[model samples]
Target: MRVGGSEYQFTGTQSHPYWFGWESMTTENPSVVLQWKSEGTGEQHQQNYPVILQVGGGLLHIWYISPGEVWNKVGTAPFSARAWHKVELGIFARPDTTGWFQVYVDGQLVADARNARTWDDRGNKPRWGVYDSKIATADQTHWINGLKLGTSRADVD
Candidate 1:
């Protein structure tokens, strides 16, 4: 589903945390469940989304793509199949080196990345669903629920 508008747009150095519930029944590798992409055009226009939450090797992986077109695996957490999991993500949207990315699973901090470029020229927009994977041969099915966006951990957690 598409999730973005003027109300959700990021301004100068703004950051936000989001929470969502996910359950997957398939062990499909590289099945992207969420992504933050820049819809505006400019450098790296053809590059992949700046941020992505996907399942690979039966684990939850957080990926960050830099402005230089480098895909970095920032964090990962063990994921159990056939069970609902609460996932919270916080991103400090900055094109410079001061940005950060964080991930929490089941109320436990899993990944915390600091002092990195986490955004592009234009702000990233959120997209949720089962993104198709080229290397994945089997069909995948997943469920997403209880999505929330807030300024603090108490608001989304």
Candidate 2:
């Protein structure tokens, strides 16, 4: 995967995360695995978007936009390069502070966030591939298998 170049492998609505189980097998790379991009105006005030899963610098980064037009890191874990890892993101979406998000690696709960303002008026949807990155020339090769999005955790398990 290249840092700047990308191809969205799958696209789905924000609600898909709630009733669905997300799973992917990937080798370590400093690139984005998935992105949930909200509507943006391309202007300075509206450049922010929603959730994204990125791995880089030996860390897995789960970032989501907050109310202040900023990207906030909600979850993170150490990366294991050259090995296949199963990653899962389970979302409990609520407009209020009651909403939560969870991250699992190899079926082990690594990060759980509560009272998070996960979405805004723009809404969210998934776009798999390389997302926007910090480096223009950073590139990587990753293998993915068993990528799934479905209505139950068992679907991915």
Ten residues in sequence with the least summed lDDT for candidate 2: 7-16
lDDT of 1 by residue, 42-144 (tens): 6545434777888877798888877657878888888866667888777776667787777888878887878766666666666777785776566667676
TM-score of each: 0.79, 0.69
Error of 2 at 107 (Å): 1.1
Model 1 TM-score (2 dp): 0.79
Q: Pick the candidate with the highest lDDT.
A: 1
lDDT of model 2 at position 55: 80
Q: Model 2, range 1-157, lDDT digits (tens) per residue?
A: 1223764333233455453334444444577887655545555323244556788877778876665767778778776777677777766554456666677877777777777655544555555666555666656555566666554566666
* Pairs that clash in candidate 2: 1-140
Per-candidate Cα lDDT values, in order, are 0.69, 0.61
- For candidate 2, the per-residue lDDT at 46 reads 31
**Residue pairs in collision within model 1:** none
Model 2 residue 156 CA deviation (Å) reads 2.1
